[model samples]
Target: MNTPQLTESIKSLVDNIDREYILLPEFQRDFVWEIRKTCDLFDSLVRNIFIGSIIYGKPTFEITVREIDRRPRKGEGSRRKLKVISLEKNEINHKLQISNFRLILDGQQRVTSIYRALKGIDEIWYVAKNEDELSDEIKSKELRDRTLEEMLYEFSLQEDPDRLSIKLADAFEISKGIIPDDIREQYFEKLSFIAGMDEAEIKENFKRYYTICIKLGELFNSEVLISYYLLNMDNEKFALFFERSNSKGIQLNFIDILAAKLYKGFNLRDKIDELKDKYHPNNLDREIIVRTIAYLVSDGKDIDRNYILTNLNYNHFNRYWDEVCELYNKVLNFLFNENFIISQSWMPYENMVIPLIIYLRESEQKDFSQMTEWQYEFIKYWYWATIFSQRYSSGSNEAIIQDANVLKSITKGEKITDRVFFSRLKSQIDSYEDIYSYSKKVNVIYKGILNLINYDAKGLSDWNNSSKLTPDKKLEDHHIFPKDYIKQQFKNDDQALSLMDCVANRTLIPKITNIKVGKKPPSQYLTELKNSNSKLDITLKEHLIPNEIIEGLYDEFFTDFLEERSKLLFELIKRNVIDKEKSIIKEYYQAPKVKGNIKIFATYYSKKVEATFDIESQKILFLGESHSVPSATNKAKFYLTGRNNTSTNGWRFWKFIDENGEEKYIDELRKLSRK
Candidate 1:
C-alpha cells in the first residue's frame, strides 16, 4: 500500500538513469523494436524540437519498470516480491513526488530512447552528422561556441549547416519563415530548458511510473493481474512488451524449465549437452532427450502440464538434473563403451532389460570392463530384442518396470549364465512373432528358466561357453525388411509377413555397417565378419538362416528352430526339476474341450394340446406339441411345432402338423430331423 514517486527536469532523468532499471528478468524476452519504428520516434521528437513547439504534456511516452524486492523481513521466512511501476504524467514542479507518475504498463523502449537522446548519448537523427562530411572545426566545436541564431537555424533544417554550402543554404531557407522576435531571448530560453533538465527527471519518472501505476496495485500479491494484462493485449503489442519488459526477452521454454527441475542442483544443460555429445552426437534434439529423461525419472508420478510449462522452479530443476545426469551416465556406460562405437536403442522393453544388466553385473561381480565379449553380446541382444519387439512397448511404465525387476531377479549373478538367460530370451523373442498366437510364450519362458535354475545348475553350463561369444556386444537390431526397405517393398500389405520385423527376427551386428547390408542375404556380412575377426566360424547354423527366406520358407525355418530350441529347453527343465510333481509330463497333457448350448422357441395356437418327448444321449433332448383350434362343427384343424436340442455337435429333431382335421404322426419328420 506504500506509494512514492519522483519527477525532476530532463537533465536529472538522463544523469541519474541506472542500467539496472532497464533490465528485464531472466524470465522475460528479447529486444524486438523494428529499426524503422525506432527511427520514426527519433525523427518526430527532433522535428517537434526544431519547430520550437512547446513541450506540452508528456507525449504519451511511458515505460513500465519491474524490480525484484528482496529486502529482509521481520518474520521467519524470506519473501521475494516483484514491483512494477509506471511513468505517466509530467507535473508542474521539478520536485520528485508520486503524482508525477505515468501509466507505463509497457513501452519501456520509447522512454529509454527519449532518455538517451536528452543525455546526448543518442544522436537525434536530424543533428547526427557523418564524420566524412563534417569539417574538423564544426565536428570538434562545443555546443556553447555555436551562435544562438546559427544553432536555431541548424536545428530548423534537416541538414547540417556547418558541413557544406548546400546544407547551410538549406538551413537558411528553412529558418527564413521563423520570425525571430528576440533571437537572444529565444537562445537564453532554449539554453535554460536544456540546462534546467536533470538526470533525476527521467529516473524519478521511471520510479514514479513503476511505483504508482504498476507496483501500487496488489501485483506483488497477485501475479494473475499481470498475466491477465498480457493476455488481453494483441499479439504484436504484447510481444513488444515481452521483449522490452522482460530482461532481454529470454523466456525459458517448457522443456528448459523441465530440464532445470529434472536436473535440479546440477548443471543440467551442460550434462544434457555432454550426454548428447558422448552418446547421440548426431542427434542434437536436446528437448527430446530431456523429455525422455523426465518421463523415466517421473516413474509414473502424475505431473501437471502447467507445472511443467509455467511453474518450473529453479531448486526443483537442480535436484532433478542431478538424478537425471547420474542415470544418464549409468545408462550410457552400460550400453556403450568409452570408445562410443556401440549405441543402444531406447525401446520400452529395454526399460526392464537394462536394469537386468545392472543386476547381472552386481550379482556376477563383473564390472563392464570385466564382462566377457560373449556375455556382452548376449545381454545386448536380449535387451534390444525385448525393447523393439512391441511385446512390452505398449505396456505402462509401471508394468515395464515390474517386468524389468522380475527379469533382474531371474538373471542376476550365476543365474546370468548362458543356458538360463538365452533360453528365456529366445522364448521371449519367439513370442514376438505371434503376440496373440504365442500368448503364453513369456510366462512359459519365465517359468522354464526358473524351473531349470531351480534344479540342475549344470544344465545351463553350455550357454556359458566363451566360444559362443561375439566381440563388443555391440549389435543393433537389424531388420531383414530394413524398416525403410520394407516400407518401399510392401506398400499395400499392412498385415503382410513383412510387418513381423520384430526382435524375434532381429539380430545384432555392427551399427551403421550392418545397415549397409540392408535387406541383402546373410552372405553379404560374411566378408566383413571374416575381416573383423578370423576366429568367427560362419556355418549353416539353423538359427542363422538367410534373410531371403519368404513367407513359406520362414514358417518351416521358424517351426524347426522352435522345435529344436524347445527340445533343448525341455531337457534342461527336466534336469532341473526340484519338484517332480510340478514337472510337465507329456502323457498327462490333454487338449481343452469347447462347451456351450443353443435353443430355439416356437409358438402355436392351442385350445387343447397333445405333447410328445424323445430322449437322446445325456447331451440332448427334443419336445413336440400339437394343438387344435376351436370349431363350431364336429371338426377343427390342428397345428404342431417342435423344439429340439441344439447343443454344439448334439442331436436334432423335428415335428409338424398334417393338413388333416385329425392329428397324425409322420416318420418323414424323423428322417428330416437327421438331415
Candidate 2:
C-alpha cells in the first residue's frame, strides 16, 4: 500500500497542491520554518541535492484537515487565523471528496517551501550566483533595523535597493515565454540595474540574459531532488503515525495537539499565560487546565485523556475558563488560610486540588468565604484524610472524580456514605508509623503536620524575632537537634544516627531564625533565644516544641527528646486534624507494613529488633516471636524508647534499612509499601 517514488517531480507536487489534490490534517501546527531555511531549501533544489523524503497519506477514509497557511511561518503574510471544517463524513466525502486527497504526513516544511517558490506566493525567491552571500548580507541588514523595502529589489516598489538579484517569480513567468513587450523591458531594466546599467554592457550581456532564463526555468521545473512515499492508509494507521509524529518529527503532548486542533477559536498558549498566578507563576499546569475543560464540557461525567481529545469543543472554553481559574484561586485561598498550602513549595500535588474544584462547582458556592463552619471542617477532614492516607499517590484520575462525588454529597449535608472517615480516618492517620518521623521531609503528610501546627497556633512565629512566619515567601524546615550534633554523638551507632531525621525532630520556622539558630543544639539555641526574648515559650508553642523537649537536649537524652516530640506530633494530628479538636497534640504511635522488603530491622541504640514480613500472611516474625506488624513494632518501640514510651502508635520506635542501604524508620518503609 505504498511506493517510495524517488522520481516524483517538483512539478507534480506543486500541481497537486495547487489543485487541492494534497491536504494537511486539521491538527497540523502551521508552518514552522524561517525565511533562511526556505532559501537554503531552494539552494538545495537548484543544485539537485537530496532533501528528506516527504510522506503522503492517500487515505480512503475522510479525516479532518485544513489548508496550509497562506504565509510562511516567519515571513510577513496574511494575519487571519484558520477555521475548522467539522462536517459529517458522508457530506465531507461527496462535497469535498476528501478521500481523493493526499495528506502530507511528513516533510511539510520542504513541500511548503518548494510550493511557495514555484507559485511565488509567500515571499520572493531570487536567482543570484552568490545567493548564500546575499542571504548573509540581508540577515546583517535585518539586524540593523533596515526594512525589506530598503534591502531587497521589489520591482513593484521601483526603488534602487542595496541588493539586486533576479526575482524567481518574474523569471518563471518569462521562462514560459509569456511576458509582454513592456513587462519584458521591466525585467531587463532590473537585470541591467544589477550590472550597473551601461548601454554598451546591456548590448554585450543580452545573450547571458537569455541563458539565465533557460537555465533557471529548467531548475524550477527540475525533478529527482525530493523523494516521496505515497501511503494508501486507513484511519487507525494514520493516528498511529501521528502519535509517533505529526507534521514535525518530535511528538507533542496532547495539550499541545489540542491547541492546534482549536486554532480556529482560541490561542490556548496565550490564554494560559493570562491564567498564571503565584502558585504557578511560569504557567499553570496545562493538563489540569485541559482536565478542567474536559470536566465542564462533559458535565462532570468524564475527564480522561481520550474523552477530552475526542469530545472537547470550543463552546465550553469561554464559558468555563474564567470560572475554572476563579474556582482554583478560591480553593488555593481556602488552603492557604488553613496553612494546608502556604505556597507552591508546600503543595503536595497540583492534581489533588481537582477534587476541591468539583466540590466548589457542584455546591454552587458563589463565594467560598460565605461557607459555614461545618463546610470548613468538612474540607479539613477531606484534606487530612487524603494526605495522611496518601490516596492520590499515582494514577488518580478516577479517584479524584470519585471523591468529588462524595464531597458533593457533603455540600448537601447528607448522610456520609463512606463511614470510614467518621470511624477510621483517625486510625488511617494513626496507621503510619512515621507520625513522629523527622528531618522535615516534604511529603504531604509531613507538610500536613507543619500545616496542623501552624493552623492550631494561628501561625508559626519566629523564635528570635517574635513575628509571624510567612512561609509563602521564606520558610525553612529547621531541625531541632542539628544533624551535626547527632552525627558527632552517634558516629558509630547506625540506629542512633537513623533517628535524627525523623519528622518529629524537625519544625517549620522562619529562615532568619534557622540561620541564627545555626548548627547549635536546641539546649544552646533555646537558652540563647530565651535569654534574649522573654516570650520564647510562645514561639516554641507555635513550632510544637515543648520546653521539656529542649530541656533534655544533652547527648544522653537525644532519644528522649525524639520520643517526646514524636508522641507530641502523633497527638497533635489526632487532636487537630483527625478529631477536628482545634489543637495539635496527642501522644500515640502505630506502624504499617514495609514496602519492597521481605525483612525490616528496627534499631534501638546498642540493640536491634529484626523482623521479616509475609504480606500474604499479613504477619511479622519478631526475633523469636510471630506477631502482627503493629504488635511487633509496638513491642520493639516500647523496648527501644525504654520505659518512657506510652501507648504509642508504635512504629516511631522502630527503624529499617531500605534497598539503597540507607537506614530508615519502619514508617518510611510503610510509605513505600503503600505506593
Candidate 3:
C-alpha cells in the first residue's frame, strides 16, 4: 500500500486551493459539518491531535468543481462563497473555470471546518484561556461555550492576495462595529486578559507582538495529512472509489455533486426550486425528478453509481430535458388523479414512477395526445402489477432497467399479455397465502389495495362516489369482526388476534361509520346499514364484501368470513389488475389460514377533537377517544410538525401509560414497531 503524503501545511493547502491546483470533485459529498464539530476540530488542532488525513484524486482532464463553503448552513440559500485567489485569468469569455478543479476525496469537512474557524465567521471559534482551564476537556471543547474568549480577526481579501488576517485587540477587532453584543463581550474578555499583562509579559508569554503573529503562525503552520491518488480522466473509477469510501464512513451525498457537475452554469438548483414551488415535493421527490431525467435520457439504461459519475454533465440531458419535464409533470398528475398521495407514507418507491414516465413520454409520440386506450390499459396494468408484486422493493435498478426495455417495446406496438407479464413478474409476486397473510396496513401492498378499491368501488360511502375518492376524504380501516368480539370468541389466542389484523379482514369505510360500528359484529352493522341505505347491496358489491359472509355473521364463523373475503379480494384484484380471465390464476389465489398469531393493539387516539385527524379513520384510539395518528399525541406530533421539525419534541411531550404500568413516550411504540 502506498503511504499518503503528510507534509502540506494549512497555508500550503489553502494556497493550492486558491491557485486552482486543488479542487473538490463533483462526486464528493457536500460540506455539512456542524459549527460545534468544526470548533472541536480546532480544539484538536491546538491540542496537536492527529485529526486524520485527507484523500485527493488527481484526474487527467479538467473537472467541474465547487469551492468549500466557508460558511455552511442547513439550507443552500444561506450559504456564502469563500473568496478564492485566481490561479490564472480567464483567456476566453472571462468566466472562472469551474472545470479545472481538484477532487477532494476526503477531509473536506476538516478543511472547511478550519477555514470557518480561522475567519471567525458564524461564531465557530474558541480561545483557550490557560493550561489549567484547557485541562478541563468538557469546558474546553464546547462548541457554544459562552465562557471562552472569542478571537476576532480581519482578512484583507483583495489587498493581501494571500488573504491573511490579524486579530484586532490581540488580533484587533476590525469587525467591532458590526459584531453582536454577545460576541463583542467574548472578544472583550480576551482583550482584558491582554490589558492586564505587562508589555514584556504579553510579548513573551502571550505572543502578542507588533502583529498578531502567534495566531497567524499556528493557523498557517498546522499540518493536514493528504493522501493523494493520481488517476486517468475516468470519472467512473473515481466514483467507484468515492462510493466505496463513503459507504464505509459518513455519507456526504452524491446527488448535489452530480447536480452541480451536470448542470454547471445552467442553474439547475433554481429549476429544482421552481419545481418545489409548483409541486411542493420534499427533497427526495426533487432527486427522483433528476434521476428520472437521467434514466430516460440514457435510453433506459440501469442507473448505477458508475453511470451517474460519468454522466455528470448535462450534454445528454440538454437533448430531452423539455420532454422529460413535461412527461414527469404528467406522471405526477396521473398520481394525483389516481389518489396516490405523494407523501412519504402514501407513495411507494418514487423511482418506480420513472419507468412509467418514460413509457408515457414515449407513448405520447412527442405530442402528449397520441396515446390510445390500449396503451392506457397497459400502463395501468403495469403500474398496479409492479406495486402489488413489490417489483422495485429490492434490486430496483435491475428491475427498472428490465421493465424499461419491456415497456419501450410495449409502447412500440408489441403486445404484452397478462401471461407474459405475469411470467416476468412470477418470482416477485408472492403466493396467494402471502397476500392473505398480510394483517396490517403498514405494507405498501395494503395501500395499493386501498387505492385500487377507491377507484373501483363506487357509491359505498356517504361521499356518494368512491370512484372519485379525493386524498382529503378521511377513510378508516374497519375491522369486519370487531376487535372486542374477536377477542371474546378467541380469548388469549394471539394467533387469532394476528389473523384478525390481516388485510383479509379489513375494509375501507367512512370514518364515522367505523366509530359507530366499533366492536359490533359485521352482521349487525351490515344489516343496519342495509336498512338505512337502500344502495347497500351495490355498495357492498363494489367494495368486494362477500354477501355470503354478511348473511352468516356468527362469532363461530369469523375464520370462515376471513377465508371467503380473502378469496374474493384475491379474485377481484387479479381480475381487475392482472387480467380479466376466470380460473386462470386460481392456483395462486387460494390462501390457507396460517396458524400462530401475534398480539397487536388497537393503537388509537380519541374522537372528540376536531383537529385535522379523525378518530375513526386513523384507528388510533388514545385516552378513550378515537384520534388519528396526528391526534395520538406523540406519534401524531411527529407527523403534524413535519418530520425533523422537532420543535415540539413529541418524544418528550407525548406520554402514555404502558401495559407495564409505567409512563412512556409513544415514540417508544414506533421504535418497537421498527424492531
Candidate 4:
C-alpha cells in the first residue's frame, strides 16, 4: 500500500481561508461545532496530535461558492464583481471567467474549529497545558486546590486567576514566522511562572517554561497536522466525489442537498441569487424555493421533509424553476403594490408564501395586473382568510399542501369541494370575534391582522398630519388608545395591557406621527385632529376604524373601544374577505335567478338521491347543509354507490326546474350565464 502523506500545516489552512481564496461552497451545511468540540479539536492540535485532513476541490469550471458564515458573507461585502455563472448543461456561459478557488469538500468541522480558535473569534477560551513541563507536585496540587478550575487540573495557578492555563491563541501568535513584539514578550513572560513564583524557583522554571512554549510553537507551525489530496477531476466526477465524502457527514438540509445534488448539473444557487438580485433586499428565503420545487415533484402529496428529499429529482427541477421564481415575485409585487406587505417582516407566515406561489404557478391567473376583479378578489380572499384563520399554524406542511390543492381546483374551474377546509376556515375566522384569545406576543397572527387592515389602505394617512403613507415612508403600528390612558383607566386589570396591544386597537400610523403622539390621550389627538383637518373621517375610514369606534377611543372607554373595534374589524374582514369567498364563481357566471331554494335531483345505478339548490346563496344544499354542486354530488354518489369521487362534473349531475317549468340539467344554467 502507498504511504499516507501530510503536507498542509494547521497555520497554512487557517491562513488560506478568506471568503474567496478558500471557498466554502454554498452546498456545505452550516458550522455545527459545539464549544466542547472546538476545545477538544484545538486541544489535539496544540498537543501535536493528528486532527484529520480537509479535502479541497479545485473546480476547473465556474461553480457556486459561499463565504464562511462568521466571515463577511455574500451581501456583507465579500461579494466580487462577478456575475452568477450558469451551470446548466449546454448552457454554461463560456465568456464568464472561472476563478481559481479551492472548495473545502470534507473535514469542515475540524477546519472551522481550529480556524475559529486561532482567530480568537470562538466562544471557548481554549487553555492548554505543556504536559511535558508539568511535575507531579503541580499536577497533584492543581487537582486538590479548591480555587483552581477542573479544566486545567495540571496547572497550580494562583487563587481566582482569570486565566487557568496558557492561552492557546497567544502560543499561536508565536507560531507565525513574523511574530509581533507584544505577542512574543507576553507569551514568554506568562510561561515564566506556572503559579505564584518565588525568587528562588523562578530562575529554574524559566528554561522549562520557555522550552514548553518553543515546543508548542514548533508543533503548531509543523506542516503535518492538516493535509489534503486535491480533487482535480472534471465537474461531474468532482460532484460525485463530493457526495461520497460529505453528504452524510453533517445533518442534511434540503437547500444544501439540492445545491450539492444539483451541483454543475443545474446551479441551484445561481437561480436563487438571480431571484434575490432582482428583488434586491427582499431576499426570499431559500426554503420557499425548495418547497415550491418539492411541490412540483410531489404531485399533490404531503410536502414534508421526508417526501421532499426522497422524491426530489434534480431532473424534475429543470422546467419549473424559472417559472417558480417569476411567479413568486409576481405574488410579492402584488403584495407590495396593494400595500399589504411590502417587506418580508410584515408577512405573518413566511411559509404561507409557498402554497401561494405554488397556487399561482398552477392557477390560470398568471398576471396579477391583468386579473379580472373576481380573479383578484379570489386571491385576496384566499390570502386574508388563510392569515386570519391561522390555516398554516399546525401541521403546516400538510395544511399548506392541502390549501395548494384547493387553490389548484379553483384555478382549474373544478368546484371547491373542500367542506372541511372552508368550514374550518370559517370557524377559525369567526372565533376571532373575541380577538383577545388567538395570539401571544407579536406572533404571525398579529402581523397578519396588520396586513389584513391594509385592505383599504390606499387612502391611509396619518392622523393630525396631512402627509399620506407612501411607499418609502416608515410606519409604526401605533396604538389607537394611548398605552398610558389604557393603563390608568384599567390600572389593575391585566387584560387591558394585552387588549391595548391587540390588532383591533392598532393601525399603521406614520412613525413620525407615533413619535409625536407618544403617551398623548386619544381625546387630545382627536381634538388636535378635529381642529387641524376636516378630512379626519376619510382617514378613519381608510384605516377601517368605524366612526363609532373612534368615539369610544375619544371618550377613554378603552375596553369598550377594543371590543367595538374588534367587532368592526371582524365585520370589515367578513365583508371584504369572508363573504367574498363565493365570488370566485362570478368569473364564469352571473348569479342565477332561481327564486328562493330550488330542489334538484340526480340518480345512478338503481339509487335515487335528492339535493336542494339554495337560490339565495347560489350553492347546492344537501341534507340541509350547503355545498357546491360537485361536493353535494360526490356526497350523494358516496351515499348511493359507496365510491368516493373527487372529479365528478357537478353541472351535469343534477336536474332543476327553470323558470319556464322545464326540467333541465344545471349545466344549462352554466351555458346560459357563461361570460
Q: Write the per-residue lDDT of candidate 3 for residues 522-563, one digit (tens) a residue.
A: 777777777776666666676677675457555567767777
> Candidate 3: where is the Cα deviation over 4 Å?
1-270, 280-284, 314-322, 335-349, 364-369, 415-422, 427-432, 440-444, 458-467, 474-478, 482-485, 509-520, 523-534, 547-556, 577-675
Off by over 4 Å in 2: 1-264, 277-286, 418-433, 436-442, 549-555, 576-675
RMSD of each: 36.0, 32.3, 29.5, 27.2
> Tens digits of per-residue lDDT for model 1 on 350-424?
344335433443445434655655445444444433432333322233234433433443443222211212222
Tell me the lDDT of model 1 at 584. 22
- Give candidate 1 misplaced runs (Cα > 4 Å): 1-271, 274-312, 335-342, 346-505, 511-675
List, residue by residue over 128-244, the lDDT tens digit for candidate 4: 333222343443332223111222322111111212245555556666643444543565455422333333233433443334445556656677554333445433233333433
Prediction 3 TM-score vs. true: 0.43
* Model 4 segments more than 4 A misplaced: 1-271, 313-319, 339-343, 363-365, 372-374, 431-433, 438-442, 457-459, 464-472, 526-534, 546-555, 577-675
- Least lDDT summed over 10 consecutive residues: which range in candidate 3? 154-163
| Every model's TM-score | 0.28, 0.47, 0.43, 0.46
- Report the lDDT of model 2 for residue 366: 55
